[model samples]
Target: MSNEVKSIGIIGLGSMGMGAAKSCINAGLDVYGIDLNEAALATLSDAGAKAVSTNALDFSQQLDAVLVLVVNAKQVNTVLFKTGLAASLKPKTVVMVSATISADDAKQIEQQLNSYDLIMLDAPVSGGAAKAATGDMTIMASGSAEAFSKLKPVLDATAAKVYNIGEQIGLGATVKIIHQLLAGVHIAVGAEAMALAARANIPLDLMYDVVTNAAGNSWMFENRMKHVVDGDYSPKSMVDIFVKDLNLVADTAKDLQFPLQLSSTALNMFISASNAGHGQEDDSAVIKVFDGITLPGVEK
Candidate 1:
């Protein structure tokens, strides 16, 4: 059978989803967008999406593939099951789940989708909003060969790199969780280092420049700390996001009887930042948890 997906429905028109939707349109695919935000729907409509609505059931029959890019497993379950998306989709339709969720949750979702005769890909994405906008994000995915064959066009449009982990339902989510461990730790430790520099009256910009060019620099430090230096905490990604992701890491590790000291510490840092009312702020605001230092563009 020829497995070709020329039409796709995307749930969640947030930063990542909106970008992927645009990329699909750019790739000349028929795109349907579903989101609660009317403005986002209008924007996608203007971007040449074939349709936009708050409910996928409105256009589910037109979709050859469904991309779920919501925040967590709960939202994914709600959209796919409670909201009637799964029941509405045509049998054998490929569903690519790109949320940051636990491996166990991914497995459960896959089993549920199988009952509907739908193909499930446990796909989690990285590279943030900017890269997503340019169709250069990375996707770690695991699914059956049929699902991979069916989703090829959408995958090519949305991701610059796609790692096929295997034919397992949860391995993609597992890889993404492991990646989040490093990402959360790097951001937390970068905040600590910057906080120490601030305490010593060193110029944060200068510190950023030196460190970014040095061996100690990480992708998280380079990207997130720039938000700190520019004093723009407008939440490219929120503090609570890492709190959730790291908590997943912690929970997964506990299940495996493994100890993740750095990940645990980073999770606490994010928790502290969230508890301090920075939950909605950019994750770089973790630096705000440090006392007695003046942050740029904020009244101390």
Candidate 2:
């Protein structure tokens, strides 16, 4: 358990996964990358990552840990169970789930993987794709001590801040759900503020500057609002992603009888933006829900 994770595999090579793969390479680990996108794999190959032809078919042979960076619990379930990705790995291989999902699902997955003699880390990542690529992302992880010991190198390579929450599986997912709630709310609020500024004839640029330096500022306002300002709504993170994540928050709260007013409101905002055909756009595009307000990217 004290041994280093010399060889590793990461499934789902999107922005976050791609960054992490590069970091693993930088850490000098033998990294195997898997994705449906050949172009992504090609890029990783250029960066010294071995591309897995059949997901874990090639990956299962030699990974010390497998980092899962897909979209949600359903995808996580498929990768670990439906796809034969799980059975391909050797005993005691740590399965790091980095997607934001319900804690229940995380626990269930951990239990299932344990039956196969595999280790599970309910590890969800933060700081977005930019941080992920630099090996400076924050990881909220909880699992067995053996899992963490084996995953030490991978964790060191992928994160600047790591909160080892507890030995229990799914505690990490609980914290991540709370993180998403704040993120989703802040984005929604920024959109509302910018839309209000447009309605008031205030210069969007000036408003951005004022609020950013003002007490009203938040990290999401600074980060996501720029996307709105530039009109570059290309999906760094899609509106529908928050729609899904915040909805998970809503569902989980309902089970506990916990009340979350702002989360509910923000979830609807994203749902509305997605329903109006902007779901594929960046989450910042939630600002587009305001009627008749000119957005930065639009021609007047």
Candidate 3:
């Protein structure tokens, strides 16, 4: 069955997308790296994946599955619909979308793809780039059993844990957005707490050690604070990505007339960080927004 899924394509070649492409190669699948960036294509090619310049690709590759890990729903839509890729795919092809999107949007995408006789899988991933590279990422996924069966090899090639949420097209997206709700808020709180420590003239490393050992510890605090300790906000995941993701969560809640207090607050912090020209910086740099908060890298 793995050999049956000989050709696979990745739409975006950013950190997460690139990692997944490498994971596909590691699984011994024929992986096609698609991106507008020559450098990203080169990097994937260096890792033994076939590099295709999106502008000039041979249509004969006949991919069995294509993973869309682009930044947002807008980019996902552009890649599938506007680029004419979805319509060009043959029937029984599985088009898995891994972008963090609203359930409504995910359902809409599935319906559109169905018109082209393509299977749409709503599969959102977690565990960041490093885990993705090693194919150890968690996937919150929902799709028809037929779609799941046809795309089994593609699923195993990139995920360590693939949660079968439901047969519905958008069920996975619903869970993924809820995850963003917690992730965005947790990172924001970590930034605020660490910023307060800096304002109080506390040693950054010392405070990190204490909190990580004590009850104040959180996964976000432990993971994101390492960037602060090293003074490198080099965009592992950019502030603007969280700005967009949190806003998606807020909008999804708004439509249901549900209140999201912490997620709403965190969205503002990310927005402020973006508006202050830290948008492209790593999300941990959100601490830079607080007045008199010393960011080790920004000054140095």
Candidate 4:
């Protein structure tokens, strides 16, 4: 671990990626943000990040680390192997795997990257786009001390809390699963509660305030109720995002002989909403699944 991490590169410039790029710039690191979307590049460039047009930036020789903040395992693989960026990386460059992936997948990826002699961090993030943009997200991470040493700047730039859960690459991902369980169930419960209140003729705004301040308060309640209040479904994080994450929960639990009935049920609810074509909408639209309530200004 070097005392100084002069520069780092980031792949993907979606909501989360943009936040991470901004965090890196705020940390005084020379940050190169890569994305296929020119508009995304322009935004990052305007924010003081160096924008690269392709996924093919070779950070191995010059970069201290490269953070992959893409949506899923497939995107991570694409940014690394398919795009030919991994091979071009300098030896021992910290590969910060920030996507939420299965523990098995994380281990396999770590093992594969080790063949290239790269330092790998099984790091998954939380705190959403706002947090990422503010450099205040939480990182659930596990990896070699060497990897942490190399990636400290990026981690410092992006995380307000970095939980080094364990050394095994899979543990960090497993913790992320536990987080998804609480997160998924909370969102589903919040949606159902709001819909139930609306169906029972209680004002949606009143219900939002009551539950948020009462014993039933949760992070999801705070996050999703704003959508119902504003009648906005534009995705800060989509329902389909939970659909994928909760499905990973089901699959991971089954493999571990763990029964997560509550999480499983919530996964189905999110899946149903996604199947009903609300996949791109904000996850708060899960309320739409409960039937018969007009959201004031919004249509179903």
Query: Backbone clashes per model, in order?
Result: 0, 0, 0, 2
Tell me the tens digit of each residue's lDDT in model 2 across 5-90: 89889888999999999999999999998888889889888999865544677658788889999999998999889988777778
TM-score comparison, 1 vs 3, better candidate: 1
* Model 1 Cα RMSD, 1 decimal: 1.3
- Candidate 1 residue spans exceeding 4 A from truth: none
Name the lDDT value of residue 99 in candidate 2. 89
lDDT for predicted candidate 1 compared with the true structure: 0.94
Error of 2 at 267 (Å): 0.3
Residue 249, model 4: lDDT of 94
Winner of 1 and 4 under TM-score:
1
TM-scores, all candidates, are 0.96, 0.95, 0.92, 0.94
lDDT of 3 by residue, 1-300 (tens): 342466788889988899888888888888888888999989988999765667413552468888899878888889888878887777778888999999889998998999988888899999988988888889999998877777777788888899999999888998999998888888999999988898899999999999999999889889998898789999888899899899889888987899888899999999999999999998998888898777676682
For model 4 the local lDDT of residue 53 reads 63
Query: In what order do the candidates fall by TM-score, top score first?
Result: 1, 2, 4, 3
Q: Each candidate: what lDDT?
A: 0.94, 0.90, 0.86, 0.85
Q: RMSD, model 2, all Cα superposed?
A: 1.7
Candidate 3: 10-residue stretch with minimal lDDT: 53-62
Screening candidate 1 with a backbone cut-off below 3 angstroms (N, C-alpha, C), the clashing residue pairs are none
